[model samples]
Target: MSPFCRKVRLSLAEKRIECELVEVRYWERDPDFLRRNPAGKVPVLKMDGKLMAESSAICEWIEETCPEPALMPATPDARVEVRRLVQWFDDKFHSEVTSNLLYERVNKKLMKSGYPESRNIKAGAQKIKFHLDYMSWLLDHRRWLAGNTMTLADFAAAAHLSALDYISDVDWNRSENVRDWYAKIKSRPAFRSILADVVPGFPPPAHYADLDF
Candidate 1:
């Protein structure tokens, strides 16, 4: 239903975990979905008869359920770093980028509103450069965001970034390291389904599905 869901889907795929995708039209206020998750979020995961809401919780559940191809570091400090990065991407990046850009440009039209707000668009456009530069700095210092291993943090970050990228809000040329990291993740088997996603009137940029881009 949203990019957060797609991020979980990608992580599950990367781990080779089998699960079913049930799209919930959250705004519709379906009684059953609301009962399952009072928050009415799109990514309510049902696995082994247990329900889980919230993207971070769902991701942690997946990591625990399927630990093989681990997405979290073993060391305590490293794990903390991973969690910190995940929070940065899901929270800070979301506030600065996703909410301002994707919501304005795509979500507004999807919800049948007027045009994108110029102020919000401009702010989002300006803020993304700082985030990209931050990503570039991290990539320059470490093999991955949290460490050498690709962790849940990567997926969380990618989820938001990919969503914005789909709407052509991301300027890939801002940072080569970030661009390369995205290319590596984009080329993964887990990313295929996300790349293929069609958002009605919001057709993706040609390079959205192109791994080389």
Candidate 2:
């Protein structure tokens, strides 16, 4: 529920959607959690007493429900672009960076498992360069990752990037455009709660929460 949950939370905040934060230990396989989401994932949104799962689906639901300060663009083409980038971050970037760095370095220890797999960690570390480069390429050509307006794509990318930044895996120096883009997003009021998150046994880097950084 770490990166995924954080993504949903940030989206909700950005859209001014409010909900009670419920911490679900998915690994524990609690019955209550299973009932809410058979997938046993974090960030199961309970809105109007209706349960919702999957980060992307939940985000879309939020967007449809609360349209103010829209996370998706108004035009069809622009909306598609936003969705595309959202998938890129949640699926590709999450698998490459988040699962490797955050889950290996932190989650395993929290789960009372053995040390992290060096191979996975190495692969993730290596793969991140390619993703960061892709982001730089996108930012270089557009005002935002998806388009001129801030959209769900920004939140999706920021969610994964913030998690990596927490573990000190992101090389912001490699891409000034990406760095500047993140700095703008980080300065938003919606990002305040996420910047303050402190995962147990894992301390964020000094600049992780710094808006000026």
Q: Pick the candidate with the highest TM-score.
A: 2
Residues 1-213 of candidate 2: C-alpha lDDT, one tens digit per residue: 387888899988987777678666789898988888898888788888788999999999988888888888898988989989999988888888889988898889988878999999999999999999999999889999998888989998999889888889889999999999999999998998888888777778899999878
C-alpha-based local distance difference test score of model 1: 0.85
Q: What are the per-residue Cα lDDT tens digits for candidate 1 across 1-213?
A: 276897789888998877776656676788988999899877888888898889888888888878888988888999999989989988898888888899898877877767889999999999999999998999999878888889888888888888988988889998899999999888888888888888888878898888878
Off by over 4 Å in 1: none
Alpha-carbon shift of residue 197 in model 1 (angstroms)? 0.5
lDDT of 1 at 138: 93
Residue 209, candidate 2: C-alpha displacement in angstroms: 0.5
Error of 2 at 135 (Å): 0.4
Which pairs clash in model 1?
none
